[model samples]
Target: MHIVVVGLSHHTAPVEVRERLAFAPTAMEKPLHQMLALPAIAEALIVSTCNRVELYAASKEPDTAVATLRRFLADYHGVPLEEIEQNLYDYQGEEAIRHLFRVSSSLDSMIIGEPQILGQIKTAYGYAVEFRTAGLILNRFLHKAFSVAKRVRTETGIASSAVSVSFAAVELARKIFDRLDDKGVMIIGAGEMCELAARHFVSNGVTRVLVTNRTFERAEKLAAEFQGRAVPFEQFTDHLASVDIVLTSTGAPTFILGHRQMEEILRRRKNRPMFLIDIAVPRDVDPKVNNLDNVYLYDVDDLQGVVQANLKERQKEAHRAEAIVNEEIGQFHVWLANLEVKPTIVALRRRFEEITAQEVAKTFGNHKDLTDAQRKGIEAMANAIVNKLLHRPIALLKRTQNETGGEDYVDTVRELFDLPAPAVDETPLEPLDDDTDNR
Candidate 1:
């Protein structure tokens, strides 16, 4: 089976289309299992994030896999197939490998060099593993991709810069407060983004954290994980005045914190410096809060500037990372090309050994005086001659087939020798704990 990736991302589709196609974390399991159930698909993984919804699968026929995935996506999103078809991009074989490597390396992200994509990819891979959907091909490809990403992060300077929105929020807060360790951080919601922001703060040694959510249990649960205190939803505004940093990310479908409430909090603080990071999609903090004295309110768009600056710095290191990926892609292509020749090589070797065995038996029958050691020597010599004769031609054929599209040469080899079709074992592949798989 060959690797095929069919999907739309920020590069091909806008956020509106992407959101429509997005598979929520809870919703992914059923669709993933359904995709795996398709006869053509041998393995599959779905990477669904805010900006992209992609399906990476190994299938016997790429065309059939793409068609099935398109239909599945349309049905899941309740949108017409044609609508998504227009924006979808298909990458097969080597191109698919390169695409996955680039994604894991963060080069394909909206904000280049952002570290979150790696985590997202790992999460997707983990889900596929849990669902028992990923097979040997996908497991190998993804593990290699992860290794490439880790190398890029360590060997290059790409990760040194803060490029992700969450880290950018922390950077903006640092600009306002000068020190994060002494800051009091009040997280306004219990969403994933907010949780990430809180974790960033906690990692940076923030002194105090107060989490508040519409659901008190969720707030308490999240807060307790980080050794922070949870406050009642009604007390969010009151506690807002005491904190040096306020981060809000909620799904209220409306503005939860208005200008008037923020104005009162700002007044209570008595012109103390405060950093307000509003990461919510619908905008939790009022836009007018930026006008208030001693209050620095940064929204999603503001974070984009920081990410942009970080991207510019990372662009220099990206060339190095791209070179690594290209080298890896070349190596993978060589392996793939060899994969197409493996069955022919095996069959030809088997054929030669069979012929050698038959001829040896006939000769031995006539030479009854021959010793056992002599007979064994003759058999070994025959097998060695067969291997030495076939090695050069097999290597040349593989090279010619991969380079010149010489299907006729491979076909001739198969037809003349009566070789069997290539067989791919469908056993589930294990994940690598170290770099042993790479070797």
Candidate 2:
């Protein structure tokens, strides 16, 4: 059996399509059960995130399995097939394995090397395990993928930078302050962009959120939402003396606070370092404020530019990450190929021994005068012959374990020797935890 992946991703579909296709995390148990119930799918797992949704499966007949999954995706999501057919990208065999490794390693994310994808995949796999939809191949494949991702993180600096606007703000905040717990944030507007930044700060343990808007009622509403205090718009400038961080995105066309006003405010606070993030399109704080001492100002463009630069850095680091993935893929592939090698060899030896036993019985019947010592010598000779004949093929199988067409070569030998097919064990192929299995 081979691994297969049938689904869509950020590279193949837009957000509109992805949202319609995603399997909600809270409601995935039934979907996983439905997927595993399909005859073509031997094992199944679903990974759904904001930017992508993928279905990883294992089957003996890859083509049939992929088709079956595609049908399932459409029917289950209640989406029209024609609308999503062109957005799908499927891979089988080694390519499918490589795809999963890349995804788990975060190389396939919209923001390359984002740390969230690994956790997302892990969560999905956890659900699959909980539902018992994943067994053997898929569990092994995902575990190896996690190991590869861990190696990549240790070996490369792919995720060492911030690549999103909100996260970039958080990084800058860290650089400005020794610790966030002591800092206070004053949000100047109720825009979604500023709210995200505020949330990031609050999540980082900035407990004080002083919200102010033109309308006190709106300011009070937003402040209550974050469980903080609200200040009147006229009184915000006075409270500026108490805040260390200022986040603003308002409808004002001109600068609300000039350098002169900031200088007076800084003097009252003994010139304590202040961070200003003006996310407004028309620019909230005056550009001259950047020239003031101990004041750091970052506008929307500045934050986005930093995010873009970090993205480029991530892209460069992604090349190194991909190399790591390729190396891991080779090792994992060899392990998979060798999974059936020992079993096949055991079966072949058993088959030869059975044939030899039958021949020996017939020979003894024909030559009734043969002694017991002669019978023992004949059995030992048969065993020696079988061992010598099997040595070269077994050696070749081990040597080509990581090479192309290794499984096919093993299959040809099995058929040529008329060996029985290996029994299927749905239990996870145990990981390399044992002393002997470590190889």
Candidate 3:
């Protein structure tokens, strides 16, 4: 048996192509069932995220399976194979296992070390379990993949830092304040980055949100979205004392917030520390405002620097994560190798036992004068001889299954002994944990 994966990702395909191949979580059962129906595929799972779409399968004929998966993708989405063939990539054996490990560990993400892809993969696995598409190999493979991801997360700093500007602002805010639930945030403008930062702050437990824009209607709209109140543009300074965090992003060419304004605001708040994020390109907050006591100001450059530094840290941690993946791949490959050899070993032993039984029966029938003791002696001697004769070959098979040309040895053994083909394994798919996200 062989494991294979065929699909396209952000590295090989643009967003338009990815979108075309994407699968909806609610509708996975049909395609999974269809793929399982194909002769070339024995087990299957589909992982569809915004950045990637992949079909992972276990098969006896790997080359045929890869072609089947690629065609399945094109046919399912009603796209011609030629249009998407260039964007597809396929891997088999250890390479396929390596790809899955890297993806589950977030090392293959467009933004390395992001955590969402892992959860998305878990959800896909959940669908496979629910639909009974993933059998023995995939059940174990996916669980192992999850454990490898967990190890990477625990042993490395890949997910320890924020890699985006908006998230960096929130990270700095988190460091300054012990808790964000009680802190109030104010947005001075309606720039996209400012809105994104505001959303990040709210998701991270900021309870209060104050939005101010040149247009009162825009402020009111944004404030309502956050479940907070809107402050008029001209009167936003008056409300600064009520907020602990401030994010400013406006198209104005000059500084809208100066040192004098922050000094008075600090006094009104009894000199409490405040986090000011100035993400506007031309600088909305005056550079001199950073000199005020108990006030922390991070302009665009400052936040960008923080993001760059954090990205580098994540990159360093990613190398460690790759090592973890490689170690796991080796272990999983051994398990797969054993899986491939198990049936052959069983069949070889059975073949020897059957031949011995037939010969022993013929001898007893022909003699017709054997005593019970004599028959027992003959049976024991026959079993011992069979075992002795088979030991070396079975030993060789087990010892060599994990090495190069292992499958060839299995084939040669089967041919020499004239053993029947190994039976297809249809073990029931095991259910994934309900809390896959936590792991």
Candidate 4:
């Protein structure tokens, strides 16, 4: 069987496409069980995140398995196959292994240095294991991916900076305030991006958070999730003077806070420093407000520039991480190639023993004059002959176990000896070039 990956990510598909194929965390068991029930799949793992939705599986026919998963994805989500197939990407064998390692190492992330993907993958793997959908190959493959991720994290500075816009905003906040431990933050919108930035501030030790939105209940819901207070929309600026940071991402067409409004607000607080991040596309705050003394305003483009600069820094370390993954892939491929070595030896021995027993039975039945003792001696001699004849070939196979084309050696031995091919529940991944006619 081959290790195959089939799915789409933020790189290949937009959010709408990804969402259609997404698997909810709480609803994984049924789909996992269904995946294992497919003919081509042996072991299965599904990773669904905001940025990607991918299915990894072990199967004898990589193409067939990929097709099966593609159909499964559309059918399960009640989406038309045409809608998702165009966005899907697939990999097989060594390439599949490389893709998974890159994903675990965060090099495949939309934001290269972002660290959330590794944990998300781990959680997905946990679900597979819990549901018993992940068998031998997948369990081993995911474990290797995790170890590679750990190595990348410790050995490279890939995740050293803020790669996401929300995170960049937080880093800038830290830079201005020296520390966020006692800083007050006010979020003027309850949108996803706004909430993410607020959560980052809270996580980074912001002392307080106050959320406000056009719909006051949405503000209340988001504020409760972050363990913060919710301020009414009209009265939100009443506490703006008290906050050291402001994040706004509302959909309002006009500016919510103007330069004139901020001038009065700044006076009430004695021109204290305030960091304002306008992540909204429509511009939540008036551009002229930026000129106010002690007020630093940054829009989405500025935050993206920070993210871009950090991404460039991360790109430098990505080479080191890629090298680590390449090294690990070689090690894993060796282990995978060797899976057939021992099983083939055992099957070959069993085949020889079976041949000897059948021949002995035929000879004993024909020669009725032979004594029981003589028959026993003949059987012992036959067993020794079979063992001695097979010893050299078995030893040679073991010695060359780490060499490429070890499967070739096994296949040749089976064909020369006319032995039945070793049976396996799931095939370990093999490079497609070396994957022909092993059976």
Candidate 5:
């Protein structure tokens, strides 16, 4: 059987197209079973996330399977095939293996090194298992993919640093405060960035959160989500001294907090250090506030600069990850090649042994006068001859299994020996000891 993947990712399709094609996890069983019902599909798994939708399958006829999957995706989603056909890509055999490893390792993500894709793949594999769509090849393939991802994470620093602006701001906060357990965070707006940064702070051990927005109700709604207190927009400065970290993203054209107001707030706190982030387009905090003693101020551009630098660092680490993926692909290819040739090897050996036994028995029948010891010696000689004659061909089959025309080589040998091709087994394999956790 051949491994194949057919799908569209963020690189090939827009969110609107992806969302339409995506399969809900709760509803996966039906589609997975449907995919397995197709003529060429033996095992199937679907991975659907915000950025991509893909189907991974094991098939005897991969080219036919790819075409069938494209039609299945369009028909299943009630979409016109022409609408999505151009976006669909298919990879078979080794290329399919490479694509899966890269995806599991997060190298194929829009933001390389992001960890969510790995978990998403794991969840998708779980659905395949629960629905009985993953057979031996897919089960082993996914487990191998997971191990490759883990190795990439451990050997390289791809996910070691913050690359998003909101997370980068939190990283900056950690550098200034050293420990956030005793620190309080104050968000000056109800914007998405402010909410995300606040979440990052809270997750990083910030104990208190204060929220204030021009719309008091919005502030209260956001504060309730974080279990924080909502302060009135007009009286926000009154609560400033109590907060060590402040994230501001309001719509005010002029600076909301000026140099003089921060000086007073500093004095109220006995000149304690403060971290101020101004992510607003119009500049919420005064640029001059950065000059104040014990105050670390950053604007949108500053945070973006940090994000860009970290992204560059991540790109460097991604090169290392790519190398790891390449190395893993070779290893997986060897295993897959062995799997493909195993049946042929068994049949070849069985054919030779059968011929050896038949010729030896015929000789014994022709010489009935021979002693029992002589017959045993003749049988032993025949067995040794069969082993010696079959050794070279078997070794050749194993060694050439991963090369081009490997399947043709196996077929030719089977035909030359008049050995019938073995039937493909569809049974699921027992779980390996190492893959027991579904990690």
Candidate 6:
């Protein structure tokens, strides 16, 4: 089965289109199972993040799998198939593998080199593994992707600057406060982005955290996880004055924290500096709050600007990382191509050995007076002769099979030697032991 990737990302589609296709964490299981159930799909994994919704699958017919996935996405999202098709991008075979590697490494992220994508990929992979939808190919591919991501992060400067909006908020906070250990951080909503920002703060030594949500129970749960205090939605304004860093990410259709409310909090805080980050789509914090003195209010757009600047710097390092990926891709291709001729090489060797053994046995039957050790030595010599005669041709075939457009050469060798085609097995091969060295 060949690997195929079908999806749209921030680079190819706007947020509106991406959001329409997004799979909520709780809602992912059904669609993932459905995709895996497709006849053409041998294995599947779904990576659904805020900016991208991609399906990576091992399938016999990649085009058919792509159509099936596209239909499934359109039907699940209640979007017109035509509309979804226009924004979708498809990659197959080597390109698909490269795309997955790039995405896991954060090279394809909306904010390049942001570390969140790697976690998201791991989460998706874990889900697929739990659901038993990802088989050997996907498992190996994702594991390699994870390793490549770690390598890129360590070897490149792509992750040096914070790029995501949530992390950017933390970066800005560090710039304002000499130390975050004494700061009080208030998360206005129990959303994913808000949770990420809260985690960033907790990791960076923020002392006190206050989680307020529309639903008090959800707020309490989120707060408990972080060992923070939970406050009701009504008390958000009351707690604002105590917070040094306020991050708001609510799905409210209207503004939850307006200028008037923030101005009152500013007065109560005695003109102390405040950092407000609004990461919501509709913007929970009012845009007018930026006009307040000593108030450093940033919205999604502003955070995106910071991310954009970091992306530019990351692009420079990305070129270097891309060179490494390209080299690895070529190596992987060579390995894959050589795999196609391995069976033929094995069969050819077996054929020569069988002929040698048959002749040795017949010759030995007439020489009954010969000692057992002498017979064994003669058999070994015959085996060695067969190996020596076949060695050059076998090595030449393997080398030529690794070249570009080498499949034709492989097929020619197979046809000339009357070698049977190799069977495809998902199971890994066992390592050779010392006893098997004679072969």
Top model by lDDT, which number?
A: 3
Over 296-395, each residue of candidate 1 has an lDDT whose tens digit, in order, gives: 8888888888888877879999999999999888776665556667667777788878888999999999999999899999988988998898888788
lDDT of 3 at 427: 59
Q: List, residue by residue over 108-156, the lDDT tens digit for candidate 2.
A: 9877887788888888988998999988778889889888888777788
> 1-439 in candidate 3: lDDT tens per residue?
7899999999999999999999987799999999899878989999999999999999989999998898899999999999999999999999999999999999999878888888998989889889999888888899889889889988999988998899899999988999999999999989889899899999899999999999999999999999989888999999999999999988899989888888999999999999999888899988888888889999888899998999889999999999999999989888888776889999999989999999999999998999999999999999999999989988998989878778888889889989887774765544554443431
Error of 4 at 135 (Å): 1.0
- Tens-place lDDT per residue, model 5, 79-127, is 9999988889999988999999999888899988888888888889989
Q: Measured by TM-score, how close is model 5 to the native structure?
A: 0.85
Clashing pairs in 2: none
Count of clashing pairs, candidate 1: 0
Error of 5 at 278 (Å): 2.0
Query: Which sequence of candidate numbers ranks them by TM-score, best first?
Result: 3, 5, 2, 4, 1, 6
Q: What's the distance in Å from true for residue 66, model 6? A: 6.0
Clashing pairs in 4: 1-427
Question: Candidate 3: where is the Cα deviation over 4 Å?
Answer: 20-30, 71-83, 190-192, 208-242, 250-253, 263-272, 292-294, 421-431, 434-439
The candidate maximizing TM-score is: 3
Clashes of 2: 0
Clash counts for the predictions, in order = 0, 0, 0, 1, 0, 0
List the lowest-lDDT window of 10 residues for candidate 1: 430-439
Q: What residue pairs clash in candidate 5, if any at all?
A: none
Q: Which of 1 and 2 is ahead in TM-score?
A: 2
Pairs with steric clashes in candidate 6:
none
List model 4 lDDT by residue over 82-145, tens digit each. Answer: 8777899999888999999999889999778577888888889889989999887888898888
Q: 311, model 4: CA deviation in Å?
A: 1.0
